[model samples]
Target: MVSSGGAAGTSATAAGAAAAAAHSYKQLKEEFVSNLSGGSVTEIAQVCAVAPVVSLLWSVLQARQSFFEPYTPLAFIVDFLLNVGALLLSVTLYSNAPLLLNLLLLTVATFIYLIPADPSIRRKKAKLPPNASSKPSPAGSSPPLGVLSTKPFLTNYRGNMLVVTCICILAVDFRLFPRRFAKVETWGTSLMDMGVGSFVYSAGIVASRPLLKEKAEGKTSPLSTRLVRSFRHSIPLLVLGVVRLLSVKGLDYAEHVTEYGVHWNFFFTLGFLPPFVALFQSALKLVPSYAALAVLLSVGYQVLLEYTELKAFILVGARDNLVSMNREGIFSFLGYLAIFLAGQDAGMFVLPRALPSRFGLSKRYTMLANMAAWTLGWWGLYFLVTNYRVGFGLSVSRRLANLPYVLWVVAFNSGLLFAFALADVVLFPGFYGATDARVEKDMYETATSKVLKAYNRNGLAVFLLANLLTGLVNMTVPTLHVGAVTTVGILGLYMVTLTGVAVGLDVYNVTIKL
Candidate 1:
């Protein structure tokens, strides 16, 4: 579920460099091929492999007119080298490194990069004036938590409400519709259930955009804005899907073309959030903050499942009837919406504290701290998996909304995030040191500068790319088979590559530095 950092370190020029930079992505693809073929060139391969990711992180940190902008590029190189070194050493010690170690490295590096420090390069890259008029930021901008837009609140609200309503009603229809209504096995059932639920979650964020109106006037929205942002971004894909539908036979090219399909899931849903949030700033005053939303969705849903079993008719799976399925109708969307909010909120809350304030590891002490934190986190995760011997199992998947299942996902999420935080702080030191706490000034103003600028600016694009990539992976790989453990490796690389590339391109395209 973790993704590579997006393009945000350097000015749009750097992203252009990366895009036009023939050496990066191609080299990375070769590295993947090497991994499969067992070819040598591991050292050079590793360097090329990690460089883009590091570069992207640097750009994100510098995109904001922050104190740390000067240090982003250096931070990128240092973190990149450190992560690569860590990977090499870890691999030398073992045949394959664990996921926990990788996450820890990223987390620690990111955290260390936020703190301000000394500049690495004498002549810094010239950033576009923060007030430049040539570049108009996409709706989403700023850190994930505070990310919002300046659009009318009602506009977002109405759109989101409709999407959520669609999902709820569809979910209900699938559950209770007559057999004739569902001619294709569970076609109407599964599609309506999951599709409608996800859409509603997406819609809610769109509706909530007005809450962040003050923040979204000019800046790009953060990744957390995905619940709504996804919807907005998907409009193109959705339209393309319609075109594809009308142009081609439903079963001919359409059914088989998973990779190239116009319709998708996560990205489309994530794109609408920033605009929605921008539309409704006053809304935040009335509703709970992102954290509360997460707790409300997750814990509240858990409680309802424990106590209420009114709508069990629709929740048809291995864990059916544990709690009523009816609660999931609207509440499920709420729950998912909470998680989406939480992801963005957590990123915002934690990013500033994690990275150094200036640039270039201020001192050896911070670097050591970053490394130590990562080591401890990695060790803790290793112990948990080894001691508990909890293998990945779909048993929980069948148990929709089960407490244990939910907890499991939460734990996995927290662990991964903690690890990535440590890696970011330790490796990058004070990469994105310039992010000011003054988001109330304006959303657009806040976004152009910050460690997460790329994610804010191009989150929708990145989400779209990742979703499509994920879909392609799903289409090509046998994710369900017990023997598909090897396939899991593909997800790791996919996440890292897609996120970095998407972010980089977004920054390059959206933010034109003069």
Candidate 2:
């Protein structure tokens, strides 16, 4: 009996020790997460580990044909793995490397795989006589392989990218992942900022298209009428901003100066930049020239802000009384205007022209080359200004919308658009031909396409819905106390729910246009 009691006591002691160890492990995990840096090794490992699963899911759903149709299943699997591995290595270790090397490498690899030695090219070459002239054919003489579309400002690609950005922002806001995973301040420049800038710049370009096109064609309206129209157009944004601000403040949600709110950069850009740009275009008579002038003016404005220490005044609240006025909103409007003007310039170049029915390899190559040149030029300028203009205070300040910021926005947007155009050419080779209807029907009829179309159709509504849901979720849930895995699960559910609602509304032809 004494021996049996001793054995039982030993068993109980072992059980207590095991329970204590489990508790210690849980506490350690919590502490580790709380103290994680902006770019934690663990966070990087997690991203890398999950990337393949994410890629696999994306391939099955949205990237079905685009990814798998061009290559065999085995090849697709191998390439996906390699691409994800490269991306993980680049993002985690060499974050400062130029222009996301992983994406560049993947794009190049895909391009090469799709454009392998074509029998058609060999046959055409064989038919050519030995003494035939090697001069390139005229641009319009032959049917081309594919043509770049003129209306690229707010296309499905940009919309999808915006949706992804919105999701990331929501995830960060909910603390579903480590703060380092989506921390904006981690890098000198971040993909998150660039994504936001791209959306805003596209919005500016789209909003200004009609007015700029009309003015370019010498069909100018009266100044008073133009101003009134601009104001009328801005009414919706103004109302939305006010409503969002009130909701956020009333609900006592966390506030950030950069995201959408009463003082959001987007709100001020839509409300004030349009009339200003229209008036400037009226005076200049050339949209591109006005864009250049806007750049110069933006530089001057940045210098003025620096000289007067306006950023300090607003950020540090040198004067407490002026704090209520939200000088950040008032001053940052200039930078946003600069970005809008740059978009206007891009639109002037790409839009307002007859798009070719067919774009040949040579033509497409030339276009890509031109885009690359422009991207390089802007990026070089950004590098120079940011590196050398320290005394002048020029860096990628999203708040200030400085010269470097504008250049970065323009450079990255141009590069992404070019990449997307190239991808479209490869994915839908029949897109540029007279059989466009068939291609569109086949591609657009897919479930993935429908959902993307829904988001594209009601992007603003989706954004507003996300904001509202975010507030509700924060109110109801212990978001901060949740584990990372639980947080991710919640985020996924939220995004899927949002996507479903958007798709349903789209199917019913209900768009909340503003």
Candidate 2 has a TM-score of 0.67
Q: How well is each residue in 423-482 modelled by candidate 1, as lDDT tens digits?
A: 333333323333333332342332222223443344334444544554455335433331
* Global Cα RMSD, each model: 18.7, 10.8
Local distance difference test, each candidate: 0.35, 0.54
* Model 1: CA > 4 A from native: 1-249, 252-288, 317-331, 347-459, 462-514
Residue 35 error, candidate 2, Å: 15
lDDT of 2 by residue, 152-258 (tens): 22254545554555565555544434355543431234445565666667776566567556755778788888888877877887787777667756754555543
In candidate 1, where is summed lDDT lowest over 10 consecutive residues? Answer: 180-189
Worst 10 residues of 2 by lDDT: 128-137
